[model samples]
Target: MNTIDLQVPHVIWWKDPALRNLYLAMPVLMLAATINGYDGSLLNGLQTMDSWQNYFGNPSGSRLGLFTAIMNLGGFSALPFAPYIADFFGRRIGTALGIMIMILGIILQVAPGVTSNMFIGGRFLVGFGSNISIGAAPLLIMELAYPQHRGKLTTLYNTLWYVGSIIAAWTVYGTIKYSGSVAWRVPVALQALMPFIQLIGVFFLPESPRWLCSKGRYTEAMAILVKYHANGNPDSDFVLAEFAEIQETLRLERESAKLGWAIFLKTPGNRRRLLLIVLTSFFSQCSGNGLVSYYLHDILSSVGITNTTDQSLFNGGLQIWSWLVSICFSVCLVDRLGRKTLFLIAGVGMLVTFSIWTGCSAAYSQTGNTGAGSAVLAMIFLFYGVAGFAWPGLTVGYSSEILPYGIRAKGLSLCLGITALSGVLNQYVNPIGLAHLAWKFYFVYIVILVIEVLCIWFLFVETKGPTLEEIGRLFDGHETQYVESEEDKA
Candidate 1:
């Protein structure tokens, strides 16, 4: 079999020199995902600490909900303005500034916070500062990655989210034995580690070449593209072709004046992009993942696993499993399997797992049956398996590639903004729902999963295998400028 004609699809690595620098920059962007994941679990573990509560006003009832909601609220509140910062200053500075605000937030949280309000304020600032970094990571990868590797690279950030979560889970778990504020304070203080690592890494990485080109820094853009995509070969035909494609696309975006906030609603294609993005983001949250992600300890308690140490260990093990699943799925399967197939598989599997999970939970709650509770525990692992392959992996990468460059960063901001709102609602209501609705609360997710499946079948499209610029054609007519050569796309 001739290699040229065979054209088999395989995940390539360790060959390209450009990938060396690209891989180096990836850790910087991935820190945002890791921190996002860490926040989900750190607070979970902190809440279990008696000393943490005694020091922080022992919040309960509505106040407890407010504690969690503030972070999501701060993030949503920041999104509208944050995108403007990203669009104006470029992704690198936007990320640094966001991380700076986060550093301030962490300082407040660790400063012997003797009041509930202090921790709340610190958590709020943490969300406010972190949103830009989270939103910008995907955009940076989308613009900088080669067409063949773009989907996997962008999705890789979500996998790192679990890496962060695992670290938080284990950190908080290990600190559980410490008396007084040290148990909680030590973990909260550790939050600074990821951001500082990201800041240093970002210090060495290049700005998005597309963003550079958008600002009319064509020479700089070409240099980055050459360095990262062409091994510094400026005269390579592939480099010249990609550069021309980017330039032409930017020209169209400029001439049309389709940019900033209004463009999302003003243009038909953008309106479609916005609708799909918001819908996907919303559906991802409602799929019952957050029920486990934020409150797995409570979820385990509902299933009769009451020992604190057991809960912590179970949570840590589950997080490690999740991180491993996501890393495998994103690295190997994403490119060949395509978004539509993976999403449908994930949606269906989640729907089934959740439906069975609700039954198990109801059985355990009503009859006090050990086997029923065991079944519920099993479903947690199953739901995570399906979910790790979808929301935190495939859907995230797809959303980043679906938007145009003119509004790409802002569009991701809007997408991340919508998730923050859904997340706030979910995080706030889940505890109440657990108390009042019990097993019935899961029915809400059951219905949501059905709708998520239907929506993915009808509204979602495959975004794999296209250059980010070429993906524009799916959303707008003007972006359909590339002429296809007869060479096998693989």
Candidate 2:
């Protein structure tokens, strides 16, 4: 086989009942990303509700920023501890723990006549818990998926963000017909649904086999591989090859793994991995999508679309469009096109759309031209359509895939942490910028998007056609040495 060929083996997962069951259980983890998407769109939707604005004092400036930024702060607070839980307790337990905390947050959010303090507190817990689960989910999904299916399964993991967004957008749109607090409370209370589903679905999931191997439970690890990857046949060639590959890779990793945070900086390969992780996480949040994801109401009002119904309709429509675009690319193109290609496409596409968006916003501001305002609306959808290609698919999965087993959980935690911190800054600054500078604020993202494209071109490597364990060779070169046994050599 040519080394760069991206084609995966043609295994029909549904033909094998065990593999079928394994795939069915994936939603337990995928919903972690969904929770985050729902939270973002839910806030955007609530800001448009009259009763919500009246109840909350129509928070603007720093106060409104806090309403949006607190969640990321809460998620950041949990980052340092989340990986420890994931690494020590097991991925399944870590996920369940996060969901349980998030449910507590929903209870606080839905309490009758909830005070601002209590609501903020609830948002904090929800962010905190959601980050913990999000930190663990991609790692487990990649580790558990059959090698041929791993890329699609892992990439598709975050794409479900749009699924949650779609639900929140339309839910908010539907509830807008009511004229009371129920308009907002209904949407906020529904945040609990995904976590509840996750809590139940998680019980049915198998523990990550690589994690079991790391803990010296070799028998248990092999048993899972045998059952799911090879339909209960321990003697099957597929099962035997996979088991040997995992054992060999894990042995090499333990020998070279670094201690503490040194793992991110101990060597050149580790340094490259750290750079990619930080840049990827930062770009995912700061690349102008934050403006739309959390503050579509503000954007619409600035353009004279003050009617609540029109704003809700546009928000709902955008989510549906985003979901469709994300689903197509993640399932069909992520593997075939490779990581770097899709990322470059996203960067360049966002740059073009956002530049036009900025120009139209300026024209609308200066002349009050409804046509320019209309153009700005079209640009918003184009921007996200371009963004959906990579942000929803690659952000978490690409970062997770590049790290070796020793630091997978910890590295992912750092990725999410950086993402939260970047989000904090963007959420706080965006409203302030829009209030003061209006369209001028968009130029910042235009500049950042240019840098994003350059970085993707120069720094990002193609991580196609390798197993999770084997991909390290692209970074470490001769440092990640694997010996082929005679049975494998044949």
Candidate 3:
């Protein structure tokens, strides 16, 4: 019945050049999120661009829906193996491989004519690569980030999603001016640009020191730990303590069981963590985000706004708005507000938006009022701002943090794997529903978000101001690990 006052980080930002340099890798990983976001938003953005449709043979109704939803299938298929790739070969290798695969996908997508075979294949590869890059990047970021600033840094991955989404939206929006096949081809081709930079950039950055330690590359891990955490002072208490904790966590995992699926299931503390992870991830997608993310144009067209220009404008603006709001949310609120509080508060706002969208869409369905449909249309931005603040990067960030080092990669993979699979359902089913059920599809999410809010309120714990190793203690019967400094309490 007592209060939980989340404390601030112990680290000072401006004074620490070493921490700043370590945080540098974050933007690189962000590009991974951007690509993932762009891909998710791309088909819809391009779908709104007639030039794209014309070259791609203007897929409509079911075929168009399949193309959009198909990417999730790619993500789903890759999730199970992605963890293994990341864990076995290493996070950097996994990220590099994902980028390379995505590049191949980009090449195939720009082919002339409908090129349906290439289209599906290209999109599938993009999905596969994105899941790998997106999944691996966050783990690297979380592993490397100083514990005090980890939450804020890790959640920014989601904000980068909007960065990618906005770039795609504007790329398509701007390039919509081009005529014939060139219009769509140029934008689609442009997709290769940033990720290519990221593909090259990953090599310059340090590997996750924790991952290095787990593999018995202690010398390399110690070098990275001192460089980042201790500001080149190997003897610094913070660096020594953090390095020891990482070693301890790895030792515990090694003693308990060999790394595999069973470790996650067998441990009671880990079992609870895994359960919450699945539930959190399930809520992330099922909250009806896909309805807007993948099919905003479709939703708009339902209201009789058939013009490509208007659709592109609205979608572009929404991406920008979502990006800005999420960036602000991650930078300002994530650490300050803490994870659970924001999720709960923002869930209420999302609930309001969804309920209104359903009512408005339903009324437009029956009344055929342009105003009613427009009201539903405007709600998408409100929904973006609210949901962006609540779940976005924080959900996955929290999922990764709660896990023990033994199964951390696999656990994070499991969480995202479920989210990706759930997205497949959203992508596949929603198109069919939008085609047939129209506004009624909103009702399903309305019910879902209500449950999502309840779950957050009852289940989620405050995760701010704790080291990842310390957080592990909260779940396991292990002795209190990585306790925050007293200065952090102030």
Candidate 4:
């Protein structure tokens, strides 16, 4: 089989004779994903604890819903500004700054005598801090990885998110049983450690080569790329070609408009790309995954698992299995199945599962029938394994690759901003649905799923195995025809 030449320039230099730096960098980046995931999901288990009520003064009905919703609200509030920060300061700086904010947020939550207002304020800070990682990580990973291995490497970040969720579930389950305000604070407070560690560790890593090149620091960017790609036969012409491509891409971007908000809105094709990306991100959140992850215990209670211990254990175990399944599937098929196909399949599967789930929930609520309700609940979780886990992991990877290099960070930030907003709405509405109309709540998810399917089928494009240049062409509407080539096979 013919190997597709990567076309990198020869002037780039690696740290050593081999490309070990690139391999080492993967773990560091993945660690960022893991911590981000863990903290994001940690709240899942803590919601049921007595400390939850203590911190929030026994919030009931609509108030309880608002309390839960406020977590996402914090995130949404900061998202619009995340892009500007990332663009103006650089991806690494934006990420570090966000983590620092998260450290403050966690401290407030853990301190003694924190009122509900304080708890909300603290969580809002956490949400704001957390968005930086989600917004920046995908772009960083994409710029760093080789085209052939990009999908698999980027999915590692998503897999770690599930790992974080599982950890949160188990940590809260174990700690909540011990009896004290610490039960909840301990789990919530632990999130502080992640950002602190990330902040310190990130300083040691190099800035993104793409971002570096964007800023006209071509020599430094080339050096970092060399370190990552050194294992490729240095004698081969592939390196020079790749470097030329990067240079050309950067030149085109700079000549176009310097990659600012003006460029984002002025370019017609870019505007469309931004819209699709935002829609996909919004649908991903509104699909009710957030609702399920945040309110699993309540959902179980509606189906008859009223015991707190049983609920915690069951919910925790489900998260574990979901994470495990997502990792397995992401590692195996993300490259093979491609982004568009997996999304369509997952969307349809979720629609079916949630539809059944909605009916089962309604039945259980009306007739007090646990048997059918239990079965539907099980299916809802199974759907999570198939749909929830796969979609998020792949969505970030796909979104990162689809936009042109010039607008990559801004486009990602815009998409993520929508994600943050939708997530806040989902979180806010989840408690309300659980409190007021338990069975009817999932109907919102079902509606979102339908919209997701329609949008994906109509607007989404297949981005598997394309070089950044080819992807840019697709985005520009200049390349409507796709020609299969040997490089695409990898």
Arranged by lDDT, best first: 2, 1, 3, 4
- Report the C-alpha lDDT of model 2 over 1-490, residue by residue, as the tens digit: 0122223346799887988999998977899999879988899999999899999999998888999989999899998899889878888999999999999998998898799999999999999999988877777888788888888898899999988888999899999989788999999999999889999988688898888887999899999988888789888777776666667667655654545676677678889999999999999999999999998999999899999889989999999999898888755799898988999989999999999999999999999999999999999999998887898789888998898776778889998899988989999999999889888999999999999999999999889777664687788874543222334446
lDDT of 4: 0.70
Candidate 4: Cα lDDT at 455: 86
What order do candidates take by TM-score, descending? 2, 1, 3, 4
lDDT of 2 at 25: 84
Top lDDT hit: 2
lDDT of 4 by residue, 373-478 (tens): 7877688677887684456676567677777766676677766667767776777777877787777878878888898889888888877766666666676655
Between candidates 3 and 4, the one scoring higher on TM-score is 3
What C-alpha lDDT values do all the predictions have? 0.78, 0.86, 0.78, 0.70
Clashing pairs in 2: none
TM-score of each: 0.92, 0.94, 0.91, 0.88
Q: In model 1, what lDDT does residue 409 have? A: 69
Candidate 1 C-alpha lDDT tens digits along 228-279: 7777787877777778767766755564354347776766677778888888
RMSD of candidate 4 to the true fold?
A: 5.7
TM-score of 1: 0.92
What is every candidate's alpha-carbon RMSD to the true fold?
A: 5.4, 4.0, 5.4, 5.7
Give the per-residue lDDT digits (tens) of candidate 3, residues 1-490: 1112223236785588988776765688778877767876677778787666766677766787678767777877887888888877788888889889889888888865537878888988888888887778788888777767777787887678777777888888788878777777877888888789999888888898877887889999999988877779978777776777677666555654453576666656767787888888888887888887888878888888788878888878888888788778755788788888888877888999989988888888799998998898778888888887866777778888787666777777787678878877777788888888888878888888888889888887777766665576677645322222234334
